[model samples]
Every structure is written in structure tokens, then in C-alpha cells.
Target: MQIQDLPYPDPGVPDVRSGSRFLWWLGRNQLGGQIRSMAWGLLHFTAVSAQPFCVGYAVQAVVDRSGTRLALAGGLMALCCVGIAVGDTFLHRAAVTNWITAAARVQQLLARKATQLGSALTRRVAAGEVVAVSTGDVEKIGWFVEAVSRFTAAALTVVLVCVGLVVYQPALGLVVAVGLPVLALAALPLLPRATRRADLQRQKAGRATELASDTVAGLRVLRGIGGEDLFLDRYRRASQDVRHAAVRSARMWSLISAIQVLLPGLLLIAVVWYGVQLAREGRISVGELVTVYSSVMVLTYPLRHFEEIAMAYSFSRPSARRAAGVLSLERSTDTEGSRPADVPSGDLYDPDTGLFAPVGRLTAVVCGDPDAAGRLAERLGGHPAEAGTTSVLLGGVPLDELPLDAARAAVLVQDKDPVLLSGTLRELLDVPASGDVEPRAALAAAQCEDVLEALVQGSLDAEDPLDARITERGRSLSGGQRQRLALARSLITDPEVLVLDEPTSAVDSHTEARIAEGVSRLRTGRTTVVFTSSPLLLDRADRVVLVHEGEVAAVGEHRELVLTEPRYRAVVTRETQDEPASATGPETPSEAAPITAAGTAGATEADDDGAFRGALEEIEETA
Candidate 1:
């Protein structure tokens, strides 16, 4: 494959059983490119190898004082130069194309697998390792793939050169035949040590990268808890470890490089000295001795390919293994079967959790364990806790059996901590069209006017909420603001079944109550399941189910459940002592005091004040 033909339509299913197999699979996919590269490489090396013979003939012609022989030698030299130029130029082009295309194909396969695995990817592989493999490891694998053809050509040239020497001068050819193998094999013993150090360096670097990524992602939280310095120190230590490992790896490679240079130098000295003795003894003439000496010098170049090939394979093997490991992970939830595109409308049920979200109703799941709640939320969206653990049935049909796109279209699950991608407010809310909920309605239901106002800060179009840009992961916004914005985005999707996990945990009690009322009003007829412990949201739900010991323990209205189930009360109230405090709670949405125009205006004014001050600060910085 060429560079222009990159990003293969289907990178093909990889043979990821082992690293070697994966590397072989890459080679097999690009067999045509490899052949082209190898052919060019052979031409280039062969042309280069012929230069020594031309020089030898030219010297002999000059010694004989023959004008005709000199002219012919000059002609042969010119031809060799042209061949070298064409071969070298095209060889480089073909080799680079193979390298880039191979890397692109691996990256495509990795990205596709990552999308398929979803959240389960982190569980199967370290986030840091995945990053390393997709970036550094991919380059190393491509390097090996591209080097293979060149290495083959070099080895072939060395063999042919040795054979030519043996035919032209038997004594010198024997010396070269014996010396070249020794030179190539001499570094074999040191390779194991070098490879071990390289693996160690790779491991250390991956850990450091992972730590840096995690530290950056959690920087806001770390600063909030006054743990930024602690994490910084940890990262510093990790960086130091990586540096040490790299130095050790470099030392081993340096030793190998010395061996490569030292052995070739000794072999050159031996060949020239032996050829001089042969000429002195009349075993070979002056022209033949010069040719033998030049041939040995030329052989030195191709001989280095042996060391290069070894190093490339050693490094790429581990990289390919890591890449294969990531590719090997299957989506924990089944993605098989060719089912129909449409799913019937019915309640969503997970047999594993024994929880059912009734159709066209707002159901609240109150689980004491947040982990259990998150797992149940994932299951509701057809992502089981484990592969084939159990089935979540939608309309009495297994969710896993449904086509993946159809299943996803039928349900939307919002995680407890959702990420807002870097983009304008409009782009952030841009999701697949579903029901009637518009961006405005969704933002209102999510109680996110403050968020939009906050995003408008320090902007040229200060009044245009949709045009205001959000930083990566909405890091520029407060925790509450980010949470509300995520809720708004989710609400905008307006899926038939919307599963929310702790959707309003970051918001205040008053705003949470308003959001609960707004969500209930907006999702009047759609099936919505919320996994939360807040009393405000629980009281707003049409029905409440308490999950305990991994299964549905009790099902009833919020008030009856709080009154009857102590576990439910403790979980919803956040403590045993707070259970009685819920007794005098508001009875209905109206009693909870709906979001008033004046209240929203006040919130907007407060947000705008913050935005205005931020704008002034930005202006000062620009000035």
C-alpha cells in the first residue's frame, strides 16, 4: 500500500494471538508493498556493490595505459552511478510508504478496537499502556516492518559479494566468507542484555506516562484536597525512574554499537592485510588485491544490517505484544447476531440485578453501593459487568442480541462523571437526533443556565451562549457547572430510555430539587431511570426501587419505602440519624417550588457578574 492509499477501508481482522503473529499479520497485509520495497532495495545495494568492481577495473586500465579499457571502465562507472541514483531514490520512497502505511493500519485497528471495547478497555489494559502502544509502540512496529526488506537486501548483497570474491580470488574469498559471519554473529550474545534493558525502559516509561495522564486529569480534584504537591512529587519520582531505565538501556545499546564498529574495523584490517600478502606472494595481482580490499570495505556496510535487524526485532516484538494485548480484548458485552434495526417499546430488565425500569415512567434506583449502582446503570444500556454474565432484556428481547447501533439508539446511559469534550456549547450538545427535547429545554431541565452564562465569560460574543467555547473536559468550569452541562447534553439526546447515574450529585440541594422537577416534567412520557440517593430526586420519581446485596430488595413509592425500609432510608438520607428528617419533606413537585423566572434571573445575574469579571481579567492580560 502507498501513502495516498492509506487508512485502509478495512484494516482486516488482526491475528493477535501473539506478538510475532501480529507482526506477521502486518507483513502479510502489506505483502505487495514489501515486495516493491525489497526489489528497489536489492537494486540499490547491488548497484552500490558494483562500484568496487568498476573502480578496480578502472585502476587496472590506468596501470595498463590502455585508452580503450579506460573509456569502457568510465562508461561502466557512469552506468553504476545512474543505477545507484534511481535505486536509492525509489527505494527510500517505497520504504517510507510501507512504514507510514503499516503504522496507519495498526493505528486504525487499535482505534476501532478501542471504540468497540468502550469503558472496558481500561479494565483490560492500562490507560498508559494503551497510549504508549498507540503512539511509541506503533512507530517501533512500523520501523521493524520497514527495515525487513532493507535487511533482506543487505544480507543478499553480502552473500553475492562473498561468492564473487571466492570466484575472483580463492584465498581472500575464504577469509571474507569466514570473517563476515563472525562479524555478524559476534554481537548476538550482547543482544539479550540489550533487549532486557529495552523492555525495562519501556515498562518504566509507560507507567510514568500513565501517572502523568491520571495526575493531569485529576489536577483540579488534587488541588481541591491540597494534594497537588504530593502528586507532583510522585510524578517527579516516576520521571526519575524512567530516566534511569532509559540510561541503562542506552548503555547496553551503546556497547552493542561499539561491537558493531570494532568487529567490522578488525575484519577490514584482516582482509586488506591478507590481500597484501597474497599480492606479495603472486597469488593475486595488484588490481585483484585492490578489488578484494574494496569488496571487504563495501561488505562492512551491509554487515551492519545484521545488528540493525536484531535490534529492530527485539524492540518491536515487545511493542507488537502490547498492541496485540489491547486488540485481543473483546467487548465484555456481546455484540453478535444480525438483529433487526427497530426495538419494540417495553420495560428494560436486567436479570442479573432483578431491576426493571417500567416503560414510559421515571424510575429511581436507590442503591447503597455506588459501584453497584454504576454497574446496574451500564447493564441497563446493554453493557454487562462481565462478558456474557447475564442479559439485559429490552421489550423481552436480549439487549446483547439486538444490533449494536439499534441497542445504543434505544437507550442512553450517562455516567456519574461525564466528560464534556472541548468545543462550543452547541457542539457539546450535538448528539444523535431522537425525541423532541431541544437544547433550550434540556438546559432548562438540567438547571444549566448558570453553566451557559459561565461559558460566555471572556468571550467576544458574550451573549451568545451556544458560541462560547468549553475547554477540554470543561475543566474551566466548576464541578457543579460541568455536571449540569453534562446533564443538559444527555437530556438533549432525549432517548427513549435515559439512564442517569448520580446525575445531580454535584449540584446543590435547591438546584437538585429544581432539576428533579424539571426532568420529571420534561420526560413526561419517556422511560427514564436515575440511580441516585438524593431525597429530592427520589421523591420526584413515579416509582422507586431499592437495590441491596446486588438485587432488587424493595419496590414502592419514595415515602412508603423511606418509612418502611430502614436500609432505603439510611441510603437516601445519607445516614441513620437523618432518616427522620425526611418525614416532613415536600409532598409534590408544586410543593417543592418550581424554578421561578425571578430565581433564574437572579442566577443568571450572578453568573454574568462572574463572567464580566473574568472578561475584565482577560482584557487586562491581553493588554
Candidate 2:
């Protein structure tokens, strides 16, 4: 497809059996572009090669004193120059088009794969690897694709030029022909070493990128715990490793480049020296000697393309492999028997843990192990667990058996750490929805009026709060604001089933209670499942399920469980058996106020929870 017709209607199903196969698939799809580029490249190289022959003819015409032949030679020389200019311009244009189109095609394919896999993409592949494939690897693959046609054209021109020279003067022609191959092959031995070094450098750089990504994502927490320097030092070491590997790789490539230059110079020297001897012996004319010299110089230019093609292939091969690896990932629902069907309204059930969220009710899941809670939340949305586990079913139909779009429409899972993409507040909240709830209503339900006020006050343009732009990942806002904003976006979707994991983990107790009531009021008749340990949210749940070691351990109201089950009380209140029973008493709305308003107002729920858990553990040990 042409560059203008970009964003292919269908990028087409790629052959991802291997990296080489994936590259071949891309080439086949863009065969028309490759042919167009090759045609222009051939014209350009042919016109350039003819210039030396025209120059020789002009000199011979001058020696013969023939005005007619001299004029004819001058005309041909000018004609060749025009051809060279036009062909060169068009050739560059075509080659560049090929490069851009190929890169665009790969990017589209990667995007499609990411959308299909969703959060599972990062689970299957490293985040850094995905970023590298999308950014750097794509460019490298395009470079190789674009280089192929030029390399072929240059090779053909070299072959034809050698044939023409041999027909005109066999003695000098044979010398040039044999020397060209030797020069081309001289860098072969060093290529493997260079390629190996390059691969090593790419690996080191990917590791460094991953380390930097992790450190940045948790920079706030690191600073809170005074561990920023430790992470900074680790990243510094990784950066140094990448730098050293890059230097080693560059050193090898430089050696190869030196050999290429030195050998070509030697070949030119030999050709000139032999041609002069042939002229002295009266075997060849002066025009022929000059022609031979200029021809060798012209041939040197095309020879460089050989090294360029080699370098491109070496770099792009690994990139293609990584891209292929990511594209090959399949979701649980991608297998046979999975098709789109109307979803019936019913409860959400995870057979693996025997935990079910009853329809038209708000359910709270309390699990001490955060990891277990996260996994359970994912399963509730049809995301598969380890192998051999039964799929979560909705209304007696396996969620994994339904098509991805249908499944996502039926159930929406907002992870604990939901990301807010950069855009105006309106754009951020503009997602596919049932259109029943207004943005303002969802915002109010999420208790985000304070967030809105702060955003307007901080905005320099005096735009409406909804029109204000949020920084990337909402970095300009506090953790609680980001959390509440994400919650509002989820509430707007108005899905049939909503599963949330620690939705209010970053807010204070007072705000958490308000958010709990807002969520209950907004989702009054819909099935909502929240995974949290907060007492306020737990007390608001229609039914509370306590999961222990990946199974449902207790099922009852939040207060009933706290009064009856010791384990449940310990988990929810962060209390030990040795502590006074009143400490674990059911917390009423009025009694759930902040311990100290001044101290708790500024402390996030996560920090408060961590401290409470730590203190409870210490008490248990002392008792």
C-alpha cells in the first residue's frame, strides 16, 4: 500500500511462526512498493554508471577531431546527467515511502495485538520489551525492508558494468571484476563478531530500560521509604552496562568499516597501476585508461550498499523476532469454541475459588494476601488463572467462551492501580458506555468535586475543569485524586458487572466512606464486586466474602463476620487475639472517623493500612 493509504483497513493476519517468517510476511504484503522502489533505484544506478562511458567517448571524439561525434558525445553526456538527477530524486522518494509505510504497518499490527491481549500483554511479555519492539525495533525492521531493493539494484548495476567493461577491454575489465568480489567479501569474517556484539548491546539496553521503567513507576513510594538512592544506584549500574556493551559493539563495526575502506583503496590502486601499463604498451588508448579509472571509482559507491544491507539485516532480525514473540501471544478466549453470543444477566461465578457475586447486589471480597485478591479480581473478569483452572462463568456461560469484545462489554475490571491517560478531562472520560450516567453524576458519585476544584485552581488557561488537561498518568494530581478519577471513569462505563480491586486504597477514611456510599447509590441494582480490606467499604457491601488461601473461607455481612469470625476480624481490623476485643468491635459510621484528623488527613489509606498491619504483627509477637 502507498504511504498516503496508510492505516491499512486490515494489517492482515501475520505469519508469526518465526521472526524470519514475520519479516517475510511484511515484505510480501508490500511487494508492490518494493517493486516501485527497485525500478527507480535501477534507473538511478544505470544512469550513474553510463556517465563514465560518455566521458570516455567524448575524449575519444576529441582525439579523432570529429565535430559530429564530439557534439553527439556531449549530447549523450548531458542526457545522462539529466537522467541521473531525475532518477536519484525519484529513487530516494520511493525508498523513503517504503520505509515509512513498512514501519506504520508494523506499528498497526502491534497495536492490534495489544488491544486484543489487554493487560495480559504485559503479563506475557516484559513491558520494556514491548516498548522496544514498538519504538526502536519497528524502525530497524523498516530500514532492512527499504534497503533490500536498493541493494538489489546496486548489485545488478555492478554486474552489468562488469560485463560492459569486459566486452570493451578484457584485460582491465577482468581485473576490476575479480577485485570487486574480493572487496565485498573482505568484511564477511568480522560480520559475525559484530552481529554478536550488537545483539549483546540490545539485550543490555532492554534490561536498562526495564529497570528505569520500574523505578519511575514507583518513584513516589521509593521516596516515601527513603529508598530512592538504592533504586537510583541500581539504575546507574544498568546504564553503565548498556554503555559498555554499546562501545564494544561500535568497536567491532568500526573495524569492519576500516577493512571495507582499506580494501577498496587497494583495489583502485591495482586497477590504475595495471591500466597505465596497458596504455604504455599501446594495447589500450588513453581514453580507455581514464574510463577504467573512473569506472572503478563509480563502482566503489555501490559497493557500500553491500555493508549497509548486511548491517540492517543483522539488527532487524532480532527486532522482528521480538515483535513476532509478542504477536504470538493468545488470550484464553482465542481458542476454539469461543464465539460472540448474547450474554444473559446473572451472577458472576469463579469456580476455582467457589466465590460468586450475586446479581443486583454489592459484594466485598476481603483477602489478606494482596496478590491473591488481585488474581481473584482478574478471574472474575474472565482473565484466566494458571493452567487447568475452570473459567469464570456469567449466567451459566463461560466468559472465556464469549468473544473478547462481548466479554469486556459484560464485565469491566478496574485494577487497584488504574492509569489515567493524558488528555483533557472530557477526553479522558469519553469511553464507550451505556450512556445512562452523565459525567458530572459519575464525578459526584466518585466524590471528585474537590479534585475538580483543585484542577481548575491549578489550571493556567482558566478553562472549565472538564476542559483542563491532565498530565501523563495524572502525575500532576495526588494519588487519591487519580484513584477517584479512574473510579469515575469506570462508573461511567455502566457495565453489567463491575469488579474493582482496592478502588479507594489511596484515599483517607472519611473520603473512603463517602465513596463507599456513592458507589452503592450509583450501582444500586447492578452487580458490583470490590476487593478491599477497608472497614468502611466492607460495611457497605451487601454481602462480604472472606477469601483465605485462594478459597472462600467465610460468607456473611461485614458486621456479622467481624463479630463471629476471629480470622475475619483480625484481617479487617488489623487486630491480634491478645488485644482487647473492643478494638475489633464492629465500626459504626460515626465511630470510623480518623484517629487524629490532623495526622490522618495527610496520610494515605495505603500508609495507614501498612502501619496498622505492622503494629498488629508486633503485638502478636510480644503476646
Model 1, range 342-410, lDDT digits (tens) per residue?
865689888977899899999999998898788788778876456546878888888887766778778
TM-score, cand. 1:
0.87
Scored against the true structure, residue 226 in model 2 reaches a CA lDDT of 99
List candidate 2 stretches off by more than 4 Å: 335-337, 577-623
Question: How much lDDT does candidate 1 score?
Answer: 0.83
lDDT per residue for candidate 2 within 233-327, as digits (tens), equals: 99999999999999998888888788889988998899889999998999999888878888988888888898898899888888898899998
C-alpha lDDT of candidate 2 relative to the true structure = 0.85
State the C-alpha lDDT per candidate. 0.83, 0.85
In model 2, what is the error at residue 473, expressed in angstroms? 1.4
Task: Indicate the residue-level lDDT of 274 in model 1.
Answer: 80
Winning model by lDDT: 2
Q: What's the CA error at residue 355 for candidate 2, in Å? A: 1.4
Error of 1 at 123 (Å): 2.1
